[model samples]
Target: MHTDSAAEPRLAGGPATGLVAALDIGGTKIAGALVDDTGRIRVRVQRPTPAREDGETVMRTVEDVLAGLAASPLWPGAGAVGIGSAGPVDAFRGTVSPVNVPGWRGFPLVERVHRATGGRPVTLVGDGVAMTAAEHWLGAARGHDNALCLVVSTGVGGGLVLDGRVHPGPTGNAGHLGHISVDLDGEPCACGGRGCVERLASGPHIARRALENGWRPGPDGDTSAAAVAAAARAGDPVALDSFDRAARALAAGIAATATLVEVDIAVIGGGVAGAGEILFGPLRRHLATYATLSFVRGLTAVPARTGTDAGLLGAAAAARTPRA
Candidate 1:
């Protein structure tokens, strides 16, 4: 999270080998790090995302993050660069069109990063795919051969792993559970879909539903899903109702995914997932009602263990994978 040039990172001991330069680009922030073979970040840098700026301006911010990483002594040992970007990304074309960062529409991110890194090979994947890579590598989905990893934050995003490998599909956007329509006659979603999981289970939607149900923010004036979670923990009916509805939507989506792919586990993360039992308790119960198939009867839902570093670590993990 250090934006100033004066901040110095703790350098790793000895000559670092198998190092990768990792970048996690999102609408909220852009994080960069030099990750070692052990998944430990040696040098780190971060900057606020210039989401509303022109494409070139956002690219400049990305370059700034790279510049900071390059300043670290470990830069020379890095063999390649891995990028996990908020998507709609096309890995084959090396282009990105993130929803929140409208400035980057079909932006040639791979070529730009390649040029910035002095021709070091670059690998790109959607943020959801990146998270899946991370979870499969070292988090809750480590031992599972098939699993779904989801991030329920300001938005809902997800990725899938099959046969012990991340499944990013041809366009690096295979497991986009957020846009999956769960209600045929429900509300329209921003993604031009109706009753999409994101429209129902995302942080914004959860809060909006609570507010619409006459739930008021506390003295802090905070009306985020986290606040609603706190209210639910305190036995507030409206808040609890909002979470239950989101959980139901999430359960339906997860069940549908499991039915299609036969995944054994669902790993949940991000801001709203901080609700913990308030979210998972109802989610598990609802999942039992929807995932009635024999193959999906044993599917378990778990919390992500990678924490906030999942994005950066996942990027590095992608770099180490063949063809990412």
Candidate 2:
């Protein structure tokens, strides 16, 4: 899924040659697909992500996906493997240490993927970075030269694309918007910070608020952000308030980031972002309140158009970039 470039040979839906294997490894699922060069998925398979399993077991699962892909008729000319994984990753070293998944600390991910796929050149990238890549290539932010993309799912993550190139920064964790502090005295973040954006705007944060406020559905006790969004949609006061808080936090952060970078658009994706207008409406309202920068005044916050396949497509596209 490549975007339109000025005769630079952007690979947008090209002729579908060379089977490129795409893997998206997350806390709850491991999805694999054989995508053609054109970005069309020829064969796709999914397996439950065993977050509790050690790195070795997860590697085995990854290898299992390759075996499944090979059985498809559309997977004959496979030449490379691209992986979109949870952070923090050392893209230069092809390694990862997803804090949520046990035994993933310093896992040699790229080498494992290469070995699993018969020594094919494998590319590894942060999920947030990969999402940004996908959006630039084929999704909502396609033609934008500078944009901030955030994935608000099981966790909050982000990536920055500037001047039409992916910016990995010094350690490949450059665009981690979740780690930024919005409140000096907010809840404790897993990253060991007080009141980071993640603790305020992520799915877990919203759920934690519901738990603390005793908001539930008929004695179910607590609800996820998704459930909370549903309640908010139905005019539930507590749920609506929870969304308001999350949106306000996100808006403040987004506005700050936009002012700092002068990004033209802010693209948001992931499970939690499905809250739609309930979330976006409040976020815009808060942005108006916190951001006074004229350059960022009219920045658009749009939904991600890539869906779930973005990670894989982005990984493959990133793999196409020349490494230093």
Candidate 3:
């Protein structure tokens, strides 16, 4: 297990009292933390996810991470446990079926975690929703009554904030923008959709498109989207075109979401967002073309400020906020 003790002060408000045990479960890793109400992480632990292993093995990995957190002296003060997991999670049913972790299908994650955490009330939400909560609480989306927060990485994920509250929907997958089809006759997505935003804008797709269009990697043999961003910065036509296409798809999806939800701002995060202006420049330009409707024409996109700790912070926020 890995541990971090960095203390991040809240942007505003007084220091909060009490703590919540937060867990962020993804295909790559399982992270646990003891977070106070003000969004500070007092203690943290993480473990690599044995994603390819059997369900029990994956559960053990999570349990191990939790055990590490529980070993902390502050763990006894944790009043609740919160989990932000990859979709599709059924918060109503307290189950999770993350697409990348095939070993967990309808797993009773809430119950298992509740038992493991000494029966403290356990709350579960999709990773996308969790990120949204973090943004609304302490990042770029703060003070916005309605917003859409996105994570554009290996796969695209998102969540909504409506009327100044994080809205996870009934099953905790409300603002799932990536799966929305952008092309009626384009490539099929692993989510069984045709030409979804994820198929065109995700990091893997960005790199794949660059490679398919003759954008050779550097001598170091880096073919990631970040590498493509570097090539675009160096004025590579193929790399620039790949990012432009991805940005166009993202713009279309963002525009559609704005039209549907009337979100004033869209906060973009995750590894792919690290491309900076390479992605945002084209996305903003394309968004102008698509979001011409009077109400949505003013919609703006901004970078998420929560960084990598969004998942854990969001889970803590969910644990503290009362849900209806």
Candidate 4:
């Protein structure tokens, strides 16, 4: 368990409007925060998720995190509870069935959390959608009326902002760009699809491609994508090629999205984006080849301003917005 509190000066006059209790739930951890209207996290707590455990056990961990948040003096002012969970989640059904957490299959997360928080209204959204909300509200897409926000990490996940509003779609997985097939005949993906963007652009795949292409790690034996990035920087052809291929695939997916939806900007975040210019350079170059349409040619790809706290802040943004 980990706990931290923001300094009082940041909260100062406090939120003009009350705070929102936010929960960011993922396979690795469950985090809780009391967030102000300005997106400041006043109180934060986290616990490693018992992802392999039974459904009830996982729920217990979430409850413990809530208990930690409830211990804060600001808890009483957090009138609404918002959750951003790994999906596929059914916001309409108030249930979540995250692919990484098999223990939860259509778990009634919203209802349980509502009960845990003394019946405060609970709003649910997929993690990607939550990240989009955060970006649209305060990050890279803040001034853009139409944009796509993506997280390219272990898996590629994304959400859309259209007409200045975050769109979660009906099932809360709207702009899920990872499953989009960029190479129709390349390779099968875990989502039962062929040649999905995630298959090529994910961090694991980047490292895998580099290793398969003879890019050996240095003495430290770190075989992660970050290590591959280091090798690429050192002018290793194989490492560079691997990232180029991933960049091409991501470019194809992003171009297709812009062509279909008219998004003016694509804000990318997550672990892989840390590769910096190593990935962006090729992505921009490849994008020029695919996004040739006059409408989409102007589309720009930029780094996401929101960092690790995106999930928590986005959940709070969702809690503040009125549901349609």
Candidate 5:
């Protein structure tokens, strides 16, 4: 499925050497891949997310995965270990809240990854930022100079690429797009705010609103944006309405983002993004409605081409970042 011409991978800053272990730690799963210099993954593995574990336990699970990778062909040969972890991380400090993982409040991630990865040179990055790097280097955002990459699943997260480089701010927190406000009078957010875009546009919020509208099927009735998209595709009125609401909120966010950044495109990814046109069609319509500037009008949102392995590619890119 990968169409890019493959290039020979060399050691970090030298002749292409061994593989880089890419780890993506999420609330639902931990996926790892041994990535080559050409962005090719030779081995892939995933395990259930530790739903009940504390910070130490989560780190243990990560260590176990790395140990397994080290014992297999996927083992790091010469490259480093790279991690794409959930935020909000103090990237400069290599620490994070670990979001859905309860025990990891300000866990030292870089140190953990280094210890678990056999003391290899390790790089830690935001999951959203990693996704954007993967897309820009090899997926839908490939060849584009400026664009936004968004993940719409468990949480709404984003990253930016400007002038051919991932735009992690000086503090490595530039593209935290979900916290932007859409309705100051809206719902409460985990970040302790009201009416943030994530409060209204995230997958859970979509399901919550659907329930309040008496959309039916009870609590078990379609709890994700993907479900809404399916129902919309099948001509379900309530489902359509639910997605329309998401589109409206996301469109507003898009318009505001485009006005500020004026990117060529916005590449949408993750679980919710699978909704395709059901979410994207209305999303485009909504963006059009709010756009007033000529630059904003030209902005289009496209689906990301990279799949689950995006995190690894991104992590590799981060490891290769020249020190400042």
Candidate 6:
């Protein structure tokens, strides 16, 4: 829903000539916006995702979001549509199989959206890739020819910008850093892999590790990673240890990414990153130990500047510059 407090988007320099419609689909919400060529969103609408509903029901929500945008006076000006969706997405085939949205397995989202939008051309990319696009275009990764953009929240997701362009791979699932194994012989992951970074660093896992190591929640029963972060700030040993472990795992994965592809910066965002230095401090220290190659030693990690709008903005970016 549009809010009174939401400011109208202004161009950084001057107006752009054409406009595009952008959709950001995720487990929690679906957002739609009409964006100018300058990457400014002029109108927006959103709704909570009916994640547990059948595929048709979820599609209805998406339609409702689009309907809100179509009602705008700017509709006739939008020449194309871009969608950023949770994955694994097959951009080659215009199909998506997002893990969190079971009803959408192998769903032909691009075709469905094209039909709903009265035949406007559509482009699709993974949510991680979308974030990378946004960062590379206007945020922390801007001007960096090679960069890694990450979202560390309930789950860890990432994408790469190589040779000054977003790299979606053939399937739109490249730079999936969360699934990269940092500890080859350690515990198994939900993705059927062992020692995946998400298993050790996701918010739930961080809180779980703290609890297992003897940290207790407050009377409110708030056992979230935020609570653990607070405890760490207060000098709780168990909480600190949990964050440290997560930082080490992230450092290893980041270092490996740097060594393999040679990114200059790693821009991180999402809920867990709100912990501030509790996460970055150790991550930097550990990166010193793991990213040792002469080529990768200067690789740096920084917080993402793009806020909640990254998805919609990135979708708009993809529409303007369709990946080949």
Off by over 4 Å in 2: 1-17, 219-222, 322-324
lDDT of 4 by residue, 1-324 (tens): 001111110101112378999999999999999998888899999999999999999999999999999999889999888899999988877899998899999999988998899988788888888888888888999878889999998899999988777878767788999999999788999999999999999999999999988999999999999999999999999999999999999999999999998999999998899999999999999999999999999988889888998899888887776533
Q: What are the clash counts of all predictions, listed in order? A: 0, 0, 0, 0, 7, 0
Give lDDT tens digits, candidate 6, residues 162-210: 8877887777778999999999897999999999999999999999999
Model-by-model lDDT, in order?
0.88, 0.79, 0.88, 0.87, 0.75, 0.86
Task: Give the range where candidate 6 is weakest over 10 consecutive residues by summed lDDT.
Answer: 1-10
Model 2 is weakest, by summed lDDT over 10 consecutive residues, at 1-10
Clashing pairs in 6: none
Candidate 5 per-residue lDDT, tens place, 1-324, comes to 000112211112221355777888888888887877788888777788785787777877787777667778557373676678887766666677776888888888777776666567666678888898888878998888888888887788888887777876644557777888888888778889878778777888877777678665536665566666666788878878888888788778878877888777889888878888888899888888987688778888899888877777887666655433
User: Which residue window of length 10 is worst by lDDT in model 4?
Assistant: 1-10
- My TM-score estimates for the predictions, one after another, are 0.94, 0.91, 0.94, 0.94, 0.90, 0.93
Cα deviation of 225, candidate 2, in Å: 0.9
Query: What are the RMSDs of all candidates, in order?
Result: 6.5, 4.5, 5.4, 6.1, 5.6, 6.1
Q: What is the C-alpha local distance difference test score of candidate 4?
A: 0.87
Across 41-66, the per-residue lDDT of candidate 1 in tens digits comes to 99999999999999999999999999
Best-matching candidate per lDDT: 3
> Residue 129 in model 1: shift from native, Å?
0.6
